[model samples]
Target: MIISTRRIKQWLTFLILFVLFTLLLYQVMSFFTDMFEPDSIYKEPIGDAVKVFSDYGRQTSQATFSELVRERLLWFYEIGE
Candidate 1:
């Protein structure tokens, strides 16, 4: 069986349009779904994610953040009280 050029063109056009329509529908549905999503729709107000470090940035000998650095420094110093 032989297919006509016009018929083939029409089928090609239909296939292209069908694929495009499916993609567009998918995008629209995704947009609406995102708009209505419980978590994404209503979120807490934007705020800084990092909390300020306590102790006012003062490095103490026993400070957790400075503990390793203090230990290294102590290794070089004489064991003096």
Candidate 2:
């Protein structure tokens, strides 16, 4: 039997809807996983700001501007590590 255009369109629609639904489900699962996972880096920032800079040796005033900025970001990342 020859497949009709309507039959092909129906199957294609089903496929797209299935893919979209699966993607949404996966995203939701990931969101929950990240939210509840221990040691997840998506945590609130802590520690003193000045301490973070000093810990990076920025208190010496010898670090360049770019180096200081990079170190500051590194400090933020280190909090959750």
Candidate 3:
């Protein structure tokens, strides 16, 4: 039940190379899969992966971009009713 030093070195090298090869294969496969993904990928951007920016502060009143522009325009016009 005794192993030779050369045999142990061979097994170690094999294990290391096997692990590296598996990692390489996984990366190649994932690259291909991502390349072939549907264009609708962006349609689900706010999915479970990222939900922070989509639903921001709730307690504070926030004016949208168009509303802010309109308010600025009215202020500049000085329309008093």
Can you list the residue pairs that collide in candidate 1? none
Per-model lDDT: 0.76, 0.80, 0.77
Candidate 2 Cα deviation (angstroms), residue 76: 44
List candidate 2 stretches off by more than 4 Å: 40-81
- In Å, residue 28's CA in model 1 sits off its true spot by 0.1
Could you give the candidate ranking by lDDT, starting with the highest? 2, 3, 1
What digit string (tens of lDDT, one per residue) describes model 1 on residues 1-81? 997999999999999999999999999999998888787545555777554334535765555756755765686586652
Predicted model with the maximum TM-score: 3
Q: Would you give me the overall lDDT of model 3?
A: 0.77
Superposed by TM-score, candidate 1 places the C-alpha of residue 34 at a distance from the truth, in angstroms, of 0.4
Show the colliding residue pairs in model 2: none
Q: How far is 46's C-alpha from truth in model 1 (Å)?
A: 18
Judged by lDDT relative to the true structure, which candidate is superior, 1 or 3? 3
lDDT of 2 by residue, 1-81 (tens): 898999999999999999999999999999999889889566766776343234544366777777887877797799953
Candidate 3 TM-score, true structure as reference: 0.48
